[model samples]
Target: MSSPATTPTAARTPRKAALASWIGSALEYYDFAVYGTAAALVLNHLFFPTETSPGAAILFAMGTVGVAYVVRPLGALVMGPLADRFGRKFVLMLTLFMIGGATFAVGCLPTYDQVGMLAPALLVLCRVVQGLSAAGEQASAISMSLEHADEDRRAYTTSWTLQGTQFGTLLATAVFIPFTLLPEEALFSWGWRVPFWLSAVVVVVAYLIRRHLEEPPAFQEARHEVPAGQPVSPLSVLLRHHRAAVARIAAAAMINTVNVVFTVWSLSFATSVVGLDRATMLWVSVLANAVALFVIPAVALLADRVGRKPVFLAGVLGPAVMMYPYLAAVHAGNWPLIFLFGAIMSGCLYSMANSIWPSFYAEMLPLPVRVTGLALGTQIGFAVSGGFAPVLASAVAGPAGDNWLGVAVFVTIACLISGGAALTATETAQKSLDEIDALHSSRTEAAELQALGTGQEPAAGRGAEEPAASGAGR
Candidate 1:
């Protein structure tokens, strides 16, 4: 049995896991976000034949970008259960390879002018692979870190996973800024592909770091206790005992609309609609993400102290209120105002919720179902919010489209939905990893007892009864 003497060592393990998660996530998402940047500015021009309708072409390019999200949940269904049953480390390593290999291949694909329809088809295939990898990446990384974390500091540790994503976005945009400044003739031909090709370097580095990571203690305990052949199915476990948490996470994930709007829709809106220079918008994204790097960890620390809900609530609501002003500033065509808005909205305001989500979401479910619950819930919600955001933004701002107000309203509604979802979740800030599972178990049992009293069958296949008052702190 694990003992109290092991606590200090276990605490240090999460730090190492956090470091690994940060580096791996940074490398993985760099490949993903750079593709989005290229889709907005370069892919439409290169992958599709020139047509009379440039706007329609851009929309088509973005649709291809969104196609990845459609594949994400499918990937999650396969990988999530595997992560839960096998280990976080195994799934993470596989995800990195998939994303890295697909991204590198995309860099080398022939253009539409050369390969005809085959170019876009190849692009979609690579994107599906990337999406599959990404589907398991975030949840598995957070689970690895959070499961290793000292209970009191779980939010802080898991938040670093999110910080890594922002770092990746910042790094990708920073790399692209210099490339975007190249002459147009050069940019479309090869400049954009440089970022994709750089994935080779990121993949090698991430692979080296992730190879050494150990499985989390929670998973180890689950492995030992559960019978070898009677392993719990992640989907069945979630559907029976943790369905409410999954529902709440899915709803809260709609808050990703804020990200889609800021990253994808805004990139297109600024470049295509507002006539801002592509490099300028890229720089704005870089600064905002740079700010997020700091803000995410800091807010995560705050959540550790004050509670995840309040920090998350502020994060959820902040975007709703700020969207109008931010877009108005963008509409005014002032670079300084746009910079300030981007930094505050994405960097400071959104970072609050963004930072805490990795921990907050993981805490809601037990260890056995954690990866599946998170992957399925967040990806499904993200697909709805993120996949359609660019398309919706395009429709809202039709030809001669300058309606920033309508776009702002759309973003605010997404924020409100996520905020309400956050408010409905139980506060788990003070709970330890072991206690989280137990607490959920107890609450589940209580609900079942109430149902039994009313002559209803207790929820089927609920886990064996949790011992009462068996709490453990970080």
Candidate 2:
């Protein structure tokens, strides 16, 4: 029996939690996407100035974009536990400020002409801060929204966290378009700074909205159950109880390679190699992501109804096949085909996976370590795959930059790995977090008993106990 205060019906504020998650993720990703657009369009020239080869500069700038991702795993180790221990709102507010401050600092940095080698050094530092902040942002937002949601609508509610990301990408690219078209000198000197600087305004707005968000009832209940002065360590629980779940999530997150390739690498490949107009390349992302803003929720709604695995596997595999055609359209220099394929690949196919991953991944863990597991697992996978995807895609495309086939093959392989991982997961969308935890316990006990070749049934409460209990809600 649950107390009225801890009851799901009484305590969950699904709409408010979803709204906070949506806005915070939007702002966080806007800061992130702004950096990606700049990396593709301008940062190479400004920060990583090269004397002769433009290819080296492009690679170097893309490398800095990956730098944030490289640091993200470390950030997850820190922020994940903090969020699980303290509260989701604390991590949300803290990360919002960290990302906003770092992004604003990027806009004010001196370029290579003014500061020589020190210019890129500063840019990398700011990106490090952004990475650390981003490591926890989505995971906490998802946990907050998921915990506040009704059992039947968890996937749909958590989908808004990612829905916000689509809006952010759309907004970032749209905002960067005019700046991309500016006169070369002015574009390099001042125009690029505006977008990064503008993150400040959104940060304040997000903070105001997020400040009033109540901690979800599930989290509050779990905290109350802990003995005073004896805090539970999420990392310990995670490593002891959830290693397989973490590994599965890390592999599944490789699906983000599709997103990275679509958003970052393709932009660079089209403009730098294929010699397409920069604004045209940028708009392809803008328009595709604009459609994705709508497609994401629809896909999430479908996930809730159909099951996470089918929708997830479709998202994973659809991009694998779509990669070839999308890149071919870019190579052919056909604008209509580019827009058409880009919209289908990014806007429709990729949205299916992206919108539901927060819930899909989070549902695999119990309530106590949900945020930590989600953060560490996804960050590790994102760093390994999505983080380095641009540079890897650029490298495989060959030095001549005409090898579109190799890039497509690379994306296909990554997507397949993700889809295979998705196949191993039990369908979690149809179950409550408690049911998921009990299933994990029973499976673990079954495995242990099987190893011993015993016919005896384990004690009823032995495998499924406190700290890993249903009361802890994942």
Candidate 2 lDDT over residue span 340-373, tens digit each: 9999988999889998899999988766678899
Which predicted model would earn the best lDDT? 2
**Per-prediction TM-score to the true structure, in the order listed:** 0.86, 0.86
**Candidate lDDT values, in order:** 0.80, 0.83
- Whole-model lDDT for model 1 versus the true structure? 0.80
If candidate 2 were superposed on the true structure by all CA atoms, what would the RMSD be?
A: 5.5
lDDT score at residue 43, model 1, on the 0-100 scale: 93
TM-score of decoy 2? 0.86
lDDT of 1 by residue, 1-474 (tens): 235454333224878889888987897778878998899889998888777888877987988887888899998888888887678999999988899999999999999889998998999999999988897988899999998888788888998888888888778877888998999999988998899999899888888878878788656543443232233356665677677888899899988888888877787777887898977887787788889888988888889999999999899889888888888887778898899988999889988989988988888877667898999889988888877776787788767668878888888888888988888888999876666766665543542422221223334654245342221111
| Clash-forming residue pairs, model 2 | 367-473, 367-474
Model 2 score (lDDT): 0.83
TM-score of 1: 0.86
- Candidate 1: residue pairs that collide: none
